[model samples]
Target chain A: MWLTSKIKQLLMVMKPGVVTLNYPHERPPVPANLRGQPVFDHQKCIGCGGCSDHCPARCILVRDVCQELRVMLYDGSRCTYCGRCADICPEQAITMSNSFEIACDQKEDITTRMELFMMTCQRCGRCYEMEKTNAIDRINLKGFRYDNLEQRALIRKTSETFDPTLLQQSDQYQRPSTKE
Target chain B: MSKRKELEAKLIARLRDDVVCVEKTDPRTIFIDVKRAGIREASKIITNAGARYLCSVGYDNIERDGTLGMIHTFALDDSDQFVCCRTSAPENDAIIESITPDLPSAGWSEREVTDLLGLRFAGHPKPKKLVLADDWPDGIYPLRKDVPHNLVPKGAEDVAYELDEAPPGTKIVPVGPFHPSLHEPEHFAVYVDGETIKGCDYRGFMTHRGIEKLCTTQISYNEVPFIAERICGICGSVHATAFSQAVESAAGLVIPRRAEFIRTMMLEFERIHSNLLWLGVAGHLIGFDTVFMQAWRVREQIMWLCERLTGNRKTYGMILVGGVRRDITPEIADDIRRVMKTIEDDLAIIHRAIEKDTSIHKRTKGVGTITKQQALDWSLVGPVARARGVDIDARRDHPYAAYDEMKFEVPVLDSCDVWATLVIRVIETFEAIKIVRQCLEKMPGGEFFVEMKDSIPAQRHAITVVEAPRGESVHYVITGEDNRPERWRVRAPTFPNLQAVPLMLLDEQFGDFPIIMGSIDPCFSCTDRVAVVDLQTGQASSISKAELDALSRQQQARHASLKG
Candidate 1:
């Protein structure tokens, strides 16, 4: 009777098809929209410091390292993952990734870094970043499909050091769709 | 005039000129400012006329009004109107008449104002230190404007939390400050004589995070919603939505219809996860492992679905001030329908298995009971009030969000026991599924957000309520200068329900303590910053047992004469 009772209890545990997962050997399926650690595209980042200012956790930091250098530091462990930073970003450079297996033994492994170069204002001589503002204006005036016409106007109007090839290739500088 | 207007008219007639002024913010709210001397009488008049006492909010308005401010909030369940009684006392001579002598449920709210704002309520029955830690020094109220938020004074060690005196032969058995049965740190001193519990006392608020002061002093208006979402882990969206709704009401802003539907959908989604979590916790407290495992296995899929909708499973930071951050697309609506169907199927199996079990019936039925009259006297809410045949739901009575358009019934059982509380939760889960489907089907198309360019003007007070899974969560927001609320008071449903636990523990088996306390689904962090500290410890006198019996007899004879 004791052996039969034990066997009966074991069968009942399997009613929900296996309760525990063999986590290391076989992974569970995560949804596509799961908010993991944030990923930053350095080419599109403007170093405007909006993400650092609006972050509730203060996980993102933008510090002026020198006359022409700005450093952005992010600590993933302190992040509440509320997505305020990504929403407030001027350029859509920061997006939440689907890689949620972010466990680490070392504290330094949780921190990420990005560096940017600054430009000077023509009138005030104050150091600033002009790449994103100019791009936004361009996206408003010229659509993304007009690469040939915009590049010729771009070289004539601005410095030759400014490159339009990467801007055209990425094809990311576009105004919001007319939905609202 | 409507019945609601008649109630207000009666109060104004009784107090006449003592009611300094009466203002109506909307058709649903009546704001009355009465003389400081007539507050107790006004409260008595309102309670006798069938208005449920909500909670009180206290703030420092010394600079603006030259006195401290206090507002007592009330709601009429039958007519769906909220009434506010505003009064203030001089800062130098800050004393007000107590209402706890008649309205027993207003005890904790009065005590909270006592310690936090330092306002003394005359004739308060058993006043003692609450909310602040035992080792905390006196004369330093955190909510006062003068005190800095980061001030951490050195605390005195070995300060004991004075418990009430043991009743005659019953010894005091302390249960927590942390226990396996209680998920948080709270102390319950149960006075038991052999196998029966004679009396009990509680000391909680160990989870106060000091976020209330931080939000008012440091954070801006846009960031306060994110902080409000962290008030309670299980009911995060409820707090966020309630705070945002209060702000929107104060500023007179209207959101799009689609945003309201999305907000309703998320609130119902939280109801599903929270109710399932409570079921698993209840089963674990009763020493049944199978029910706990099966309930959690069914809950895992809903967590993944929440992650799909809002990116994070638990916090789900989708709600903004006037609207939601993201819209629910057609594809996402279909996905939600599939996940909800699976939950409905799995829940039915667990419900059938537990409903017929003899052990569950024996353990829960006829245990931890409070009468219908006592439930009303204590002003209990949510499922705890519904189980006792008191039909009051914030969603149905005071309809906010898309609940006015959705059709669902408030499930009530008159059993008035732990068993009834469990059954009511199971029935409400199905109602949640039905409401979500209706919201998705009738969702309207419009702009997702209304960007307000005007700054929110100061000194507007709004009271908003949301029916969380456990009970009604009420937030009183008073807008202020510099874009933050001057005072934001949160009265979670656990605050009133937990206060009535001692009444339910009268003359019960000592083994039923955990289930009785868990019946309220207590969340200490939400009702943070104070406790009902019992101070009648054995130091009253070193009197003998025979002398105590004689003194008690004399007191009873005097009380009987007074009542007659």
Candidate 2:
């Protein structure tokens, strides 16, 4: 009877297959609803600083460097990643990304800088880069020289409004050379 | 029905200090405010009324009243009333007569007051540092009005929580801020005479995050819950829910009925997981590999459910002020119900196996018996208090969140041993399951959160208590004009219960010390440590893990040889 009981216990141990994950080699499956670091959609950003103000950790810095409203930065360090910013985003522009493995050697690498493109100015009828326009058009950009001023302005304006049609428009309407 | 009235009448008549106000706070407890000179006489009068002195804590009331306030509680055995005798002293002369002579448990309480508030405990035996580091600057109490807000009390000091000069024959054993045996970081110096622990003094200053101070400085009222939740890795939800409830009560914010149900669900889920974790640890401590494996296997079920529902296995970031971060959908609720069924089946088997194990009986039975009277006098709470038959559970007594609607039983046992505590926890797991089931069925659908529109008023104070898995978590919030608590006291349950460990471990075997300490369910992250010294300086060799293992091996070999 004791031998049978011992065999039964052994069978209980042997009944299960190996359940441990190969953690590093093959990544374990994360749940669909896992709340990770906040991912900011630069295209939808209004530069209202709502996400920054709502963030308890104050890890986000959204500033209109001049007035183009695209100069935004988020610091991974000091961010609790509590999903508050994602939860409070009016535009659904901020969502928690499933990228928890965020480690870097340098301080600059930690504060990931994701810049947004400028949309076409409705009033100017000319394409201008959001950040570059804020620097050059709005803030009297004299310190930094632009080589291809028109192209830079076009790229900035297209990025600001974030219209896919703007990229198609750029392809269709290329500027004619002055000599031609 | 008039039991409270009768007690109040007696207190009023006996004291005869018409100047001080005495009011019944609870059914059997009276709150009394007397002059500093009247404390001793008042305490004696209350004690004569079949009351035992619980503990005295000093609060820095300079911002409000320009004086330091000391409050103490005395309780009766049969009655629920604990007469709270309070007195105040000026900032310069913050002194109080020590009540250690009347009540031995007040030894640690007086030491805490002395360390935190810089109060002089007159004629207290060994009023050394209890919770502060030894090298903490003299006259700079972290909880004092004079100490400017920013400076934290730091550095190791020469004070031991319980100072014991090692006897000439006894050898001192130091077990770590970093030891294999200790899962948490704590420095414990054990003075052992052979196998018996002559004195065990714990000192730790490593895990100090200054969480309380951080809560006050950085987080807003709505955001404070989530910030406080990150204090401990294990019981994050408990801290978060408790802190949130406290702020909600203070602000008079009416939480959505659905939000209350979600909060209760989260809290019970936490209790189940935490208790399961403890069961695993206890099993591991007693050298029961199979039992440990079984406990952990069941624990993973709960962990999986937590991860699925709240998105984290450990820290469930599901708490928000006036609401929860995420509400459980119908599909997710079904998954939780399924998970609960599996856990219930596993727990039934585990419970029977644990109860039948002779090794468990040998190891835990009558090992750390804290009698009913001692438990009450020490102001102990949670399963530890319940095991000793003190009959105090914050969940039942102080109904917060949706607990008022939920039907569940609070597990209590009179054994007062390690076994009794284990039984209470086991029973509580079922109660937690009952709560979770009720919550799932009754979860209402509504908006999860309310927008904080009003700014925090300045100079307004509010006290709120919530039942965490461990015990009552009290949060004292004093809001500033800018809508943030200028001074927030995040009083976790572990802070008070950790005080009773030294008293519990008295006369216990050195080998059994770890298990006894573990029985209390201590959270060392909130606690500050002090370094203890052996006054008699001689290089004495101590017991090592290798030596202990070798001895056990030899004993096993001898037994096998004799049987052969």
Candidate 3:
């Protein structure tokens, strides 16, 4: 019985011969639907901040440098590549590229920064419209978002207008420390 | 009378004034609110009515009513229904009776509740900080509404968890934090005399990321499926589907038929890969590298297939609250069928090769043996319980997703050992392939994703179960304001199965520890670190990898000599 079993195992092992791929030299073609690092189209973006609000990882941060310009930053270091931003983008500005080999030394290589020009609402200073019926899909952070860009911190607090005091407070935003 | 009414009548008859009220949230779910004093008796009555214990869920209700709530959930598999016994206590005097004395599986749940929510269980056996670190400051329960999700309290140095006392005359062998055999970070102190095991004590949850608290406080409903998928690398779709189903049930949302079929196919794909993965790992644990290599090679096809279908290899992120995110095109369906065919043929070849191998039988047969009654007592699930002849499969019983229309066989064995688990997993892989074929053939044409018309009303509770490849995964969700769940509790399959490890490890050969633990296919990737300590002399030492390998080899040599 042992000999027969060994013979069968030998056949099984011999059938699948040398399946390992030689990577870096011989590359396999990636599928069309692979959700890799996301690429942002600056001209197509509307500065709605929908992708930032819907992001599960919160890797995308939206900050308003002024009333006219909104800086959207994608920190690839923490990105999960689940592609929620691409799915939720209203203008189809975000696309999950086919680039799976994104290993690099600096985070800036994979990161994408977009400076979008915004047109504010005439009735209100903010650019957001509360017209969506579903409350969960609505963008909660309206007006100028003053997230700390240097610290890569998403300050959940926002102002109705571009307030320098709030921006300065955000600049001093340190993580909550343990009470001694 | 219906099964729900019959159970409700029995509970109300037994505890007349203690039965507060009974509410049926849906047809299959019955929520019975009993007074805190009669919880034990109520649980007994439900169990007497043939209800299998699932898990306990504890949540903070202090902000609204100054009370803490506890719900003990059970499944009436014979009748296809669920019975949830709900009871709460005031925050000032939060003490509830522990059901662990009767249902041993509730031990971890109650301890976890005590650690996270600060709700004490009066008669809990060995309730010494299950989920919290030893140095975690008291009076700071992280699950409460007022506590922030990102609170990092100061860590007190030099404090360590006090493990249970080793049995008399048995040497302690600490098997993890980082052992060669264990892929995850969990510590098991096994008491052994010579080559035989006496008892075991486990200290895990070291890598608990507080996901429940994060999802409840930080993220919204739509984003939770993605986070929930990260709960387990192997069964990502299972957690995501269960969470989405729980929310959908709570909101009374009816998804499209095509979406259900797609969800079912995704779940089956996960089962195929996961079972094959377990098979390979089991082989590796038993020192049989041939089976490991062959099984994993067969599984790689499914991985590539999933990457094409769901846009990633694992964590499909395909499921949402209303429906699935991706639609199955005809070409993708053909691709799935082709992959399933190749996997079926290759797995059969591997199965035939290993089925009659004497070496595998010598290693796995009669190892990790637990009786059917003991398995039921610990509320073990999946292949572990099925191997022990406790026939329960959530897919057929609960019929979630598109399983109600699909027909498949659930293989059960009476061997009650690791060999049976291996055989059952292989058979179930074949069955999963069959289910995927049925799903593709019978899939209806409709919308893949649906938009929620209205906002989910707050304070509605729902529970859902999805049969992960490992076992039954239960998810309970309560809708809250701010588009997030008020309190979401996830009970992974490993939660109950791992609790019964000590019972399975009793009286087994010490050298067979790795294969025995690996028999359950524990998803311990979230856990890390290892140390060895002598309980009698109070001396701490770390065992090197070479020493552990030598020790195991020595034991194996002794066993072989005795057999010869």
lDDT of 3 by residue, B1-564 (tens): 988788778987889999999989799999999999999999999998899999999999998899999999999998889999999999999999998999999998999899889999999988898888787888889899888777868766557888899999999999887799988778899999999999999888777877888788767898999988988889999989999999999999999999999999999999999999999999999999998899999999999999998889999999998899999999998899899999999999999999999999999999999999999999999999999999999999999999999999999999999999999999999999999999999999989877787789999999999999999999999999878899999998988999999989999999999999999988753221001221221224777645654666576677547433
Interface RMSD values, listed in order for every candidate: 18.5, 19.8, 7.4
Model 1 chain B poorest 10 in a row by lDDT: B529-538
Error of 1 at B436 (Å): 0.9
DockQ of every candidate structure:
0.10, 0.08, 0.44
* Residue range A39-110, candidate 2, lDDT tens digits: 778777644444554456656653232223244567776677778767655567888777777776654565
- B372-394 per-residue lDDT for model 2 (tens digits): 87787777878888888978666
Model 3 chain A: weakest 10-residue lDDT segment is: A122-131
Candidate 3: segments with Cα more than 4 A from true spot: A122-135, B525-564
Candidate 3, residue B36: CA error in Å?
Answer: 0.9
What's the lDDT for all of these models?
A: 0.78, 0.66, 0.88
Where does the lowest 10-residue lDDT sum fall in candidate 2 chain B?
A: B529-538
Best by DockQ: 3
**lDDT agreement of model 3 with the native:** 0.88
Q: Using Cα atoms with residue i matched to residue i, what is each candidate's TM-score against the true structure? A: 0.84, 0.77, 0.94
Query: Model 3 reaches what TM-score against the true structure?
Result: 0.94
Which pairs clash (backbone N, Cα, C closer than 3 Å) in model 3? B177-B529, B185-B527, B185-B528
